[model samples]
Target: MTAFTSHFAFEFRTGIRNKNLLLMNYLFPLGLYVMMSLIMPGINPLFQATIIPSMITFGILASTLLGLPDPLVQAREAGIFRSYKINGVPALNILLIPALSTILHILVVATIITITAPIFFDAPLPVNLPVFALIVVGTAVALSGLGILIGVISPNARLTVLYSQVIFLPSMIIGGVMLPYSMLPPVAAKVALLLPSTYAMNAFNSLAMGGTADFYAWGGLLTLFVGGLTAFILAWYLFRWDSQNTGSRRHPVLALLAFVPYATWLLIV
Candidate 1:
C-alpha cells in the first residue's frame, strides 16, 4: 500500500510537469467548459445546470482519453516500465499507478467545475453532492480504463495521441458534450447512445437537475462500470512493458473489446 501511494504520487508529479498533458488534460477541458457556458447561444439557467455536469464529464473524457495515454506510451518508449519490472515491482501495480494518478487529477478538475459553475453561470448546484461525487468517480474510473486501453495497444507516443483524438472528437460532438441530446438529430442521438460519454452526460445531468435519478442516470453508471471492467481486463492482457515491441500485430485488435459494453447497451437501449 505504501509503495502504491509512493508510485501514484510520483506519476502525478511527473504528469504535472508535461506541458502537453497539462494543456490537454487539465486546461483544455476547463477552458472549454468556461467558454461554452459563457459564449454558447440560447443557454438558460436550466440548460446551464445540465451543462455544468456534462462539461465536467467532458473534462474526464479528455483527460483520460488524451492526457492519460501519452505518458504511459512515453514511459514505455523511455523504458520506465522495464526499470520497475527489474526492481521487482508487480506488473499490476505499475499498470494501475498511472491510472489512479490520472483519475485523481480528473476528480480535482471535476470538483473545481462543480463548485464554480454555479457562480459563473448562475446554474443550480447539484441537488445531491454525494451522488454527484459518485458520478464523477464512476466516470473517471471508466474513462481511465479506456485511457489505459489506448496506452496498452498503442506502440508509440504518436499513435497513442492519434488514437486518442479519434475517440475524443466524436465523443465531444455526438455524446452530448458539445450540445444536449434534445438538440441532436435522431440519427445523431442513436449514434450517441453507442458512446459511453452519452450515458455519462445523461447520468450527470440527471443528478445535477434534482430528484432521484431515473433509469438514464443509474443505467449509465452501471454500463460505465461494466465497460470500465472490460477495458481494464483487455489492457491487462495486452500491455507490454518493453519499448521494443514494434510488431505490426501488437494486439491493437484487442481494443475492440473495450467497445463491447457500449455496443451491448446500444442493442438493449
Candidate 2:
C-alpha cells in the first residue's frame, strides 16, 4: 500500500511536471474549450448546449491518447520499467499508477469545463448529474486502458504518435465532438462507430444530457465498459519490462482486438 501510494503520487506529479502531459492534460483541452466557447457558439449557436460534455470528451482524448503513450514508450526505452522490475515493482503497478494519475488529471480538467461552461458560456448543465459523472469516469477508464495498450504495443515514440492520431484526429472531426452524430454523412457515421468518442457523446447526450442518442445509450455505455476491460486485459498481457523480453508476448496486431466491443456494438446495437 505504501509503495502503491508512492508510485501513484509520483505519477500524478509527473502529469504536471512533464510538459507534453501538462499541455494535453490542461492547456490544450482548456484552450480549446475557451476557443470553442468564444468562437463555436457564434458559428453554431446551439453549440453551447453540448459544449460541456464535448470538450470534456476532448480533454480525455488529448490527455490519454496524446499524452499517455509517449511517456510509457520513453520510460521503456530508457529502461525504467526494467529497473522497477528488478526492484520488485509489478507490471500492473507500472502501468496502472500512471493511468490512474492521468485519469485524475483528465477529471480535473473535466470539472473545470463543467463548472465554467455554465457560468461563462450559458452552456446547459447535465440534467442527470450523477449519470453524467458516471459516463465521464467510464469513458476515462475505457480510454486509459486504450492508452496503456498503445504504450504496451508501440515500439517507439513515432509509432505511438501515429497510433494515437489515427484515433484522435478522427474523433475530433466525426466522433460527435465537433459536430453532432446525426449530422455526419452515412458513410462517416458508420466509420464513427469505431471511435470511442462516438459512444461517449452518444451516451452523454441521451443518458445524461437529456437529448437523443444516435444508438442505444445504455448499450453504448456498456460498450465502453467492456471495451475498456478488453483493452486493459490485452495491455496487461502484452506488457514487457524491457526491449530484450519481447519474444513471449502476443503480436502487436493483436491489439486490434480492443475494438471488438465497439464493432460488436455497431452490429447488435
Candidate 3:
C-alpha cells in the first residue's frame, strides 16, 4: 500500500509538472466547451446543459484512455516496469498509480465543469446529486480500466497512438458527445448504446433535461461495472510486464477479442 501510494504521488506530481498534459487533462475540455458555446451561440443553453456533461465524460476518456496509456507503454518498453517488479511492487499496484492519477484528474475536471457550467448556461442543477456523482465516478472507473488494458497491450508508442484514436474518436461521435443520440440515425443510435459513453450521455442528459434520471443513472452504473470488470480481466492476462524478454509471444486471439465491445456496438446498431 505504501509503495502504491508513493508511486501514485510521484506520478501525480510528474503529471502536474508537464504543462501540455496539465492543460490537456484539465483545461482542454473547458476550452472545447468554450469553443462549442461560441460556435453554437443560439444553443448556448443546450450546450451548457447537455454538452458540459458530455465534455466531462470526454475529459474522463481523455485523461484515462489518451493520457495514461502511452506512458505505460513507453515505461514497459524502457524496462521501468521491470525495475518496479524487482523492487517487490505488485503488478496491480504498478498499474494503480497511473489509474489513480487519471481518476483524480477526471474528478477535478468534472468539478470544474459542474461549477462553471451553470453560470454560463443557466442549466438546472442535478435533481439527484448523489446519483449524478455515482454515474460520473463509474464512468471514470470504466474508462480507466479500458485505458489500462490499452496501455498494457499496445506493442509500441505508435501503436498506442493509433489505438487511442481508434478507440476514442468513434466512441466520442457515436457516444453522443457531439450530438444527441435521438438526433442520430437509428443504426447510429443503436451503435452508440453499446459504448459506455452512450450510457454516460444518457445519465447526463437525464440530469440536465429533467428526464427519468433513475433509468439513465442505473444504466450508466451497470455499464461501468460490467464493462470495466471484463476489460480489466482481459488486460491482466495479456499484459507483459517485461515485453522485451517475452520475445514475440503475440496473442492475436486476445487482440481480436479486445474488439468485442466495438463489435457488440455494431451488432446493436
Clashes of each: 0, 0, 0
Q: Of the candidates shown, which would achieve the greatest TM-score relative to the real structure?
A: 2
Clashing pairs in 3: none
| Candidate 3: tens digits of C-alpha lDDT, residues 102-153 | 7887888888877777787555566667777877887887778788888888
Better TM-score candidate (2, 3): 2
Q: Please state the error at residue 73 of candidate 1 in Å.
A: 1.0
Each prediction's TM-score against the native? Answer: 0.91, 0.98, 0.87
Model 2 CA deviation exceeding 4 Å by range: none
Distance (Å) between predicted and true CA of 254, model 1?
Answer: 1.6
Scored by lDDT, the top model is 2
lDDT: worst 10-residue window of model 1: 207-216
lDDT of 1 by residue, 1-269 (tens): 68878887888886677887787668898899888888763654445657667778788888899888887787788998899889987878777887888888888888788788888777678877887788788888888889998988888777887888877878888887777666778787777776778877777777655744324678788888888888888888888878686664645797888888787766665
Q: After superposition, how far is residue 5 of candidate 1 from its true place, in Å?
A: 1.1
Q: How far is candidate 1 from the true structure (C-alpha RMSD, Å)?
A: 2.4
Worst 10 residues of 2 by lDDT: 241-250
lDDT string, candidate 2, 188-224, tens digits: 9888898999999999999999998788988889888
> Residue 245 lDDT in model 2?
74
User: lDDT for model 3, on a 0 to 1 scale?
Assistant: 0.72
